[model samples]
Target chain A: MASAREMRLRIKSVKNISQVTRALETVSASKVRKAINAVTATRAYATKAWQVLRHVAEQPGRDSLHPLLAQRKSVNNTLVVVITGDRGLAGAYNSNVIRFVSQRFDSNAVPVKYIAVGRKGRDLMLRRGKKVIAEFSNLPAAPTFGDVSTIGRLAVDEFSKGAADEVYLVYTDFVNMGRQITTVKKLLPLELEGEGLVEDFGNKSTGPTAAYEYEPDMRVILDEIIPRFTALQVYQAILESQASEHAARMIAMRNATDNAKELVGALQLAYNKVRQQGITNDILDIVGGAEALSAK
Target chain B: MTIRCEIISQDRTVFTGDVDIVVLPGAAGEMGILPKHAPVLTTLKYGVVKIRKGGKEEIFAVAGGVAEVQPDIVTILADRGSENIQDIDLERAEAAKKRAEEYLAKSAPADTDHYLIMEAALRRANLRLDVVRRYRKSGMRIPPSDN
Candidate 1:
């Protein structure tokens, strides 16, 4: 049986851990709210940008003009931009993404370059000896569009310069408060489904197939629009990933707190049992001493 | 008749409501949109976006993006925009302007891309400060500096 003193110490430590976890849970819960709002706010702009790109892409023979919309002749290299949390302890949030990347790539066939957005991904990439061309970490808690422009520009530049044939963005998708799914989205080569962006902006007067008059020719505007579209897609993905990180952290911390409480309860029970056993032992010793003295 | 005007920055929706008129800083020049405007899609310059609705007007400092105008709806999608003059952090703008100016002064003439980015930053900061100062001076009179 464990001693009462040791049990008391264990209980104290477990209680302290519970306090820390509870505090972390509260902090992450609040941060998740802001992160979710940031994602929601950027949706309108992203939707509009995508809609415009789709409309432009539908213009017959227009894909030949913009480098972003054109398909590469052959796949020589791939750029994978992984978005993970800067810090760990978020319950498989980082590992799930890292594992996904490890599983997806067979680097022997086609060379791969990594652009890590968070420290966790960077570390994983480095540990695996993968080629990481660029790394951006320690993003502000509520990241702005400017914060992500650097990554976006790099990815676009690589694809346009033929350094990378294909670019993909890997991040966590925030589905709800309780569920976040890791998703890999293609960022380059401009995938345009006829009904994709149009459905999102159905309320706008520009119907699914209506072609609007371009102010300064479609080609001129597309030169400016396509890059911005790619950048915004990256920014939106980061926002979603950030929100998911917070949600996952909050859930993980809550679980830790609950587990700590259970541990403390068990420790308290053990402490009581030990104290009772010690008391019974002391009474037995006293009675035996008295009986021996009377017999003598 | 009123047009539904929406100004969305990359971060958030700065403005979305019914407005009488919206004058955007088009790539060519300042262009105005009323209710029943023809469909036009154009890129914007870094300047002020003036929206007039019900005799009261609101002005926004838009940092370059694209604008789409329909018959009844007008949307300005920008990289950055602020409708309320109060929301523009003067200190940050001033610092950004100073940094951009210093970079411009130090950069070599051969680096046109760096120079162009600095110039754009300088222009955006100037536009934001100018709009806020104008709002402070004469509540609604947008000075006719450029068309």
Candidate 2:
């Protein structure tokens, strides 16, 4: 049973907490909208890019030219590029992805290297004594394709030079504001839809009647396009992870705000009860004193 | 017969409508397409895309990408482009061109990747500046370049 003064002080502190959480909730809500917009915009480009690559991959003998399309016979080294937010207040967003990745890696198997795009993922991997080849942190709120190109280039260079046998991207897929699923997708050994690499993009295939003519040749165009394709894939993943991060943060902040509101309500009720008890005690004391005086 | 011409970029759809004629900058040279054209797929260059429909013409500044033409549809998947002439920022384009040119001038020929990137950037900037300048000279609401 707290005194009136103690209850009043507790209520004031709870009110402050609620105010901060409410402000954070509003901020995250706006950020989520911006992140979603970025995802949709990138989706348009990614779809078209995938479609073009699929068409080229369907060509006969064209897939043999680019090294990115080749798969190694034995898995020796693997590079996992983990993307997470720099800040943590998001509920289970960063942890879910990191856990999904760590569970997949076994120390007895092929050696795994990590390339972290955010601070949270980087710190987690370092603390666990994992091999972190490169660390990129403090990315802008809305990152451009150029911003993530370094990661793409590093992955490509490693795989192409036989430094890494496999490359995988671990990220969170943004379904909507309420739902985000952690996913691990392969980034190397370029696989088209027909080869079981990319899922169907719902585009109708060009029939045999419409024989396509390439400007220079199939090989030259593919030589130029494959690198862009790899870069675009990485960029799209970054954008998706960003959107998911914002959505998770928004939901987490909203929950915090709601919980705080409930606490404030309970505290106010407790404070009122204690105040009433104090007033009643004071009245009883005064009334008893007067009765004694009258008797005298 | 009119064909649907859709110019799509990474960010947004630059232009999409039924047009009588479409002239795009092909890798070889300027190529024009009409209805019932052959099924051809080719890469695009950094230049303007002139779309004419019902005696009205629209121009778009396009960067590198691919173009696909069928009997009834012409789809352009550009890396980046703009359909609205008014949206072209001449000063920014000029600055980009200058920076790319300086980089190219200072870079060694052995650096193939940097050379290729700078070259592409310069070409894109040139095309944007060219389109915007043409619009201003044609007395469209744009003001002429100060330089």
Candidate 3:
């Protein structure tokens, strides 16, 4: 049992910790709201872009249309772009993504490289002795499309140059405030039609397909749209990851604050018990002296 | 008949409404789409998108992007653009242009990505400034160029 003075000091320290966590919770709550808004706001555009890409890919002989759409015969080299939060204290927000990626590429079947988008991921990759071709860190909280386009371009260039056979993007998808799922998506060779496409684009494919005419021809339009669409996908993933990071941080801080409160409550109870015992002992001593004087 | 026009940037949808006609700065040239027009998919250039509805006209300065024109709907996906002319800040555009120009002038062409990015930045800035200067209300005075 800690002394009364030690218990008092412990309670004070717990209260101070709760204050810091409470402040952090408030800040993260506000940031999560903004980040979530950013995520939802661009969802419409992402759906539309995906639809267009699907439509274009559905056309015959689409495989030869663009290098992005063309799949390699065999994937010799693989690049993984892992997006994580710059700072920690977001529960398992950063570690979850890092672990998912490490587990995913644990097998040395194919030669793999990494493109780290955040500080945590970069550090983890370096510590693990992974081949990190490029590292981008310290991205703005609410990054703009321009801020992330460079990563997309690097991936695109790597794919086009035959340096990387396939590119995968690992990110935490923001489902709701309380739910975030780690998602692995194919970034290169553009998964136009497959199992995941329907899930992502929804049941909007039931509508009739329109016969589209391409101005300045399809090749030229695809040349411009493919790169932009790829960049948009990367941008959207970053937005989702940022939202998830904030939400995770908000929840973690709230839990910390609650735990601190619980600790303080338990310590306060013990401190009170010790204090009462001291008072009772003092009273006992005083009463013994009184009884001795009365008997004398 | 009016055509539904939606201009979407990477961040958000800028405009979505019915318009009489929409003119896009196509990669080939300027092309206008009316209601019940043939489906057309074209690459956009760094210029203004003119949307006419009734007697009023709304203009948007779009950087390079793509325009998809269906029979009833026309979707303009701009790389970067403003919904309204008033959103374009002249000083900011000028400053961006100056910065891009300075970087382009100083840096060597070894790095293709940076060079292309700066070039696009300059073009977008130029397009914004041009759109504001040309399409602004007659009463609004043009700011003097620092050059």
Candidate 4:
């Protein structure tokens, strides 16, 4: 039972909070739109890419040329690259991804390395004193493929040099307008989709029939394709995570604003009731005093 | 019958429409396709992809990627944007070419900031220069460098 004065102050504070949340909600909504546009524009190409690669993946021993496609003899060391937002207030976006990744590792002795792309992720990993291989932050909203180049190069270098046997990417995957979930995908040693690596002529059986007589060989062609493929996917995933973050934040802020408004309305009603009761008491006391004077 | 073609890039979908024939600079060699063509897939080299849609003819410089053709649909997944012949500035492309040559001269891998970009630039310049050299398709040589 808060006094009228206290309730008045609380209502004022709640009003201010709702206004702030509402503003954030609007801002994030616009950003989400931009991010989604960027992603959607590239989706057609990505799908085509998937189809092309699926065709190639069906080929026999095609994976042999691409080292990125080459599976290691042993999974001695594993490195995970986690990407999360730098700022908070995006609902469970950052927390969900971070928590999921932490669960995956579950131990420091796994010989894991961290490549953090966002300030928030870098800070969290630094605090934990984990082995951070590379850290990049201050990315523009809806970054391009060029932005992912340096990081991609570093990862390729490490994998090629035998510093890491397996690499994984942890980021939030965009489902739709209102739903996003943390996605963990393997980066290194391309996973074969079909049956026996021997019988598996890659994802395509007939293969590209345009009659490609390579200048060097199919090996060199595949060599470049494999790393480029991995890097491109990573870049696409980063774009997805960014778009998801904005969408999540926009939705979260909208909910927060709605809750704050509801709370403010309830508090206002209580404050009004308390104030009216106090006024009624004062009027009754005045009437009693007048009645006593009349009796005298 | 005209076949549907989409010349897509990273930033956006550059062109999409029906074309009578599409010539691709395949990694193996120059390959051409007409409507009802066989299902063919091949890696594209950095060169010109000429398109003929009705009476209109155009040229596009495609970077490395895979191209797939299904009975009616011909899709090109290019690594870089296909800057058209009409849209290029010779001076800028020449400068870019010089920069790319300088970059290529460097022995270090880290120094090659964008191997694909330089390659694409070089291809685009060559495409523009070649188109300009040709008396036909002068409409494509309009120098849309500013855009």
Answer with 2 or 4, whichever has the higher TM-score. 2
lDDT per residue for candidate 4 within A1-296, as digits (tens), equals 88999999999999999999999999998999999888777665654564455555545565464566667777778878888888889998887887887887857465888899888888877787777878888888887777776777777778889898877778777878788878776666655445322111012333343333343356766666656666766776777889989999999999999999899999988999999999999999999999999999
Winning model by TM-score: 3
Stretches of candidate 4 off by over 4 Å are A105-111, A124-131, A194-216, B1-6, B15-21, B33-43, B51-59, B63-75, B83-126, B129-147
Q: What local lDDT score does residue B27 receive in model 4, on the 0 to 100 scale?
A: 71
Candidate 2 chain B: 10-residue stretch with minimal lDDT: B138-147
Interface RMSD of each: 1.9, 1.8, 1.5, 4.4
**Worst ten-residue run, lDDT, model 4 chain A?**
A196-205
The 10 consecutive residues of candidate 2 chain A with the worst lDDT sum are A200-209
* CAPRI-style grade of the A/B interface in model 3: acceptable
lDDT of each: 0.81, 0.78, 0.82, 0.73
Candidate number achieving the greatest lDDT relative to the actual structure: 3
**Two-way TM-score contest, 2 vs 3, winner:** 3
The order by descending DockQ is: 3, 2, 1, 4
Q: What is the TM-score of each candidate against the true structure?
A: 0.77, 0.79, 0.80, 0.78
Q: Provide chain B's TM-score, model 3.
A: 0.87
Q: Mind giving the per-residue lDDT tens digits that candidate 3 earns over A206-286? A: 223466778788777788788878777788889899999999999999999999999999899999999999999999999
User: Which residue runs does candidate 2 get wrong by more than 4 Å?
Assistant: A103-109, A194-213, A289-296, B1-5, B17-23, B31-41, B50-58, B68-74, B84-147
Sort the candidates on lDDT, descending order: 3, 1, 2, 4
TM of chain B vs. native, candidate 4: 0.75
